[model samples]
Target: MLVRELLKNFQELANKEVEFTGRIRSNRQGKNVSFLVLNDGSVIDDVQVVYKNETKNFEQLSKQRLGAVVYIQGKLVPTPNRPQPFEIQAKISEIISECAEEYPLQKKEQSLEFLREIPQLRPRTKTFQAVFKIRSLLSFAIHKFFNEKDFVYVNTPIITENDAEGAGEAFVVTTRNDGKYEDDFFGKKANLTVSGQLNAEAYAQSLNSVYTFGPTFRAENSNTSRHAAEFWMIEPEVALNSLKENIDLIEELIKSVLSYVLENGRKELEACQNFFDDKLISRLESAKDSKFKVLDYAEAINILKEAVKKNKNEFEEKNIKFGLDLGSEHEKYLCEKHFGSPVFLINYPKEIKAFYMKLNDDKKTVAAVDLLVPGIGELVGGSQREDNFDKLILRSKELGINFDDLSWYFNLRKFGYYKSSGFGLGFERLVMYVTGATNIRDVISFPRTPNNLLF
Candidate 1:
């Protein structure tokens, strides 16, 4: 039986015979008695097994090393006054596989940085086990949220000829030893997709509401804690939705997922709280319960400028102006210090945003929005797409984007295309925010960063 099931039904299964097969997390033994903490990875907590010298292979069981796989036939005994609710009194015990003495994960506490070196075995640790379990639950909650809202899930292509973001950060896809493009596999230049928004938009025109949850690649050489070379994105496109409606949907989705994790992942959250961040649960609750503050880009710039005026060294980038792009420091200050909750900054300058965003009436700013949370700076980014073909072409030309490459995307505007809105949420960043994991590498199973690609 799994530790989660055994613990959940301990009240009814007390004093009943049960069999458990799992890895040994900790082994404490005396001459007569041996205690083994076993974990099967179903949950963060482990089951404790107490065995006396009467059991078979008693000497081997007593000397069993950590990380050894063991099977135990035992009876659950209730311990009301102890920290754990119940303990297993082992009647029969055997080592399924003995661990080598060179196991790296000793009983001593290790740093998160040190654990990153062994991605293959770090999941056995309680910290990563909790983080990954919460990640899995959050992923399921995302699908549930969109499915209940009648959004059709679309699997976008991994390789495409067009760059959706036009940021020139796409990883090139080629199967040629020589540097010839025309003789390549696709017959033309192809690259791994950076965002699935363009493809999801094409489906939204027909399905009304569609979402794409898949892996996207970026070729940037960033080694920050928040950036990763390969990551998963959750992009959802809705037809006929304005910027305001898009922001509302983002808010609803965030709150719904937060509530789901808070309710369903209580044990994992408790484990995270005890180890990583103490304010993890309360911070998530605050975000779910509070109404997200909506501040205009102009007003936010002014707020930053006023703060800068009060203190010269308020921000590292010192220049808080109208058209300047908001950095991580600026974003964190706005949400963490100014609002103390999630803040949605809207109507950014057209120069800083993508060419696909809808131009507002002022013609200087686009109808774009960025949702900034407390610890993590920007959690979600979205905007209302420009519906006019002429304006889109003009914007593309102004940004030096090739018109021939995206001719099919341009034709969407000509063929019964109306206003649509969508956003891209970085799955790793969301996991980091929810799990209180400081680094993006901690949340991902095998993170693909600039210089790290260990399995």
Candidate 2:
């Protein structure tokens, strides 16, 4: 039976016979009766079992190891004197699976770094339970938001012939022996795609409205908390949209996702309130109703310059000029210190951004936006694409990208191009923002970090 069903029956079935099979959380003693907290991994709290009389096994059941699984036949009775509503008076208790006493997860709190060593068992902890619950809720919210808006869910290829980001940050796929290298499928090289923007663009033009929510691989070896080699991204592309409309869609998409999680995952949020900043739900709720502050790269540069002039920055930002990629410190200053929340930095330098971004009339900047939040510096990167085929080809050639392989992408423009926009939001980063878990490694069930591929 589901734990929820068991909970609903707790009051109605009080003083009645009950049977349950679950894992034991803790076993201890009282004056006469022994207590055991049991859970099936379905609910956050455990069902308390009280053992009063039996054979030598009754004492043994009371002393069962922490991670041991057990079964019990008992009577449910109201505990008016206790904190919880009910407790199970067990007539017989049977041990199922006996675990070694050296289980890593003691009842005490373990550091996140220690949990990283045992990724397989980390999800069993209270903190990870909350993180994953929020993650699941946000995922459903993404699908629901797009589904309601009449957007088609498109599955773009994981292995592809094109490097859509044009930054050469993809992990090449190969099936070769130690002595030599073999060709990829169709005798052409392939790699895990860094972004599905190019593929999603084709589908968006045909499907009119589409989004791709899937794993995107990047070979960027930056070992920051936000940078994961393999991360899930949510990219939504829409046809016949201006930059302002695209920004509006982004704002709405983020707000809707956060709102869904806050509304539906309240229990998990309460469990995780200690790990994050004090006002997580309030922050998300505020964001839902609050308008995002927008600033251009040039304006942000001026803000940074003024900070430098006044010696307000914590460290020297010698190279942080107009066109430089905003460092983590700079991004934090813009969103946390100055703007005080999530802020959008728009119209970045064309040379620094991806190739597909549309070049503005100034010819030096692209219509791009990077969503910067308080803790997670860069949660999203997206932009409107260049609709003009000639401009796209010129940009690609100038950037030394092989345009011949991207014929289908170019063909989208050939068949009458329309202005469209898309962006990529890191799934783990969003989880960090919601759960207040500081590390990305803790949010994922099995985190895949560089040189550390443990089960």
Candidate 3:
């Protein structure tokens, strides 16, 4: 029987014999009685087993080390006076696997930094178990939310010849060592995709709505708590959707997923709240209930400028002017201090945004939007794509993008393509926001960073 099953049905299972296998989380031995805390990863809590000296292997069982696997045949009994509702009275017990005395995780609490070094064994810890559990729940919630909306999921190519973001940060994919691509595997230069939005857009032209959830690669050299060389992205493209409709879609999706996690991941959230952040649960509730605030980019800049005037040292970036890219500090201030909720900053300068964003009638700004939350700066970024062939071609040439590589993408506009809007949400950042994990490496199973690539 699983620990969760046994605990949930303990009243009906009283005095009934049960068998289960789990790893010893902690053990307490007395002169005559011994107690073992066992967990099998089915739930956040563990089960307590009591065995006395009457057992033949009492001495050996009492000496079992933490993390040692064990099998137990026991009877469920109510513990009216104890903290827990019930426990197992062990009738027979056997050690299935032994653990070494040199195990890294001991009784004392280990720091998150120390746990990062042992990624293989970190999942066994309570903190990581909760973090990963919430991660899994969030991934499922995203899929369910999109699937219910009748959005088609598409798998884009991992290797491609075009850089979707045109940031020149894509990892080169080639088999030749001489830095030549004429005779390479694909007979031309290719790279790992940084975003799948461009490909998903093609499918949305026909499917009307499509999404891509997969791993993306980047070659950035900076090492930060928020940046990773490899990460997962959730990008959705919708045909015939304007900028306002796109914003509505993002708000609905976020609220739906938040509601799903809040309903389904209570235990995990409580575990995280007890360890990582004391107000994690309440903050999530506020986010799910509150309406997201919307502001124009120019207006947000004015607000920041006024804040800076009120206090000269309010922001590190003192020059709060138009057309300047907002930093993480600025974004957090807007959402955390100014609005106290998620804020949507829209209509950014065309020079700062990607070339694919639709240019406004002013010919200076693009119809781009970024969703900013309290803790995390930007959770989702999207824009209404430029549908005019001539304007897109002009933007591409202005940015000096290789026209030959993106010929197919340009052809989408020339064909019968209509207005399409979409956005990319960083999966790791969402996990961090929901789980209260300060570092991006903790949420991911095996994080790929600049200089570290351990298993």
* Candidate 3 Cα misplacement greater than 4 A, ranges: none
Instruction: Quote model 3's TM-score.
Output: 0.98
Cα lDDT tens digits for candidate 2, 1-455: 54556787787887998888887668888887788887776666678888886723686686788888888887888987878788888887777888798998888888889988988877777667777878989999989999999999999999988888777888888775432333544466778988788888988888889999999888887777877788898999999887788888888889999888878888788778866667777777777788899999999998888777777555456556877887888998888888888899999999898878999999999999998988777888888989999999999899998867888888688898878988888888988888888888878787777886766
lDDT-superior candidate, 1 or 2: 1
Model 1 per-residue lDDT tens digits across residues 145-257: 99999999999999999888888999889999786878999998899999999999999999999999999999999998899989999999999999999999999999999
TM-scores of all models?
0.98, 0.95, 0.98
> Can you write out model 3's per-residue Cα lDDT over 232-323, one digit (the tens) per residue?
99999999999999999999989998899899999899989888899999999999999999899999999999999999998889999999
lDDT of 2 at 50: 82
Count steric clashes of candidate 3: 0
Model 2 reaches what TM-score against the true structure? 0.95
Task: Write down the TM-score for model 1.
Answer: 0.98
The 10 consecutive residues of candidate 1 with the worst lDDT sum are 446-455
Q: Count the backbone clashes (under 3 Å) in each candidate.
A: 0, 0, 0
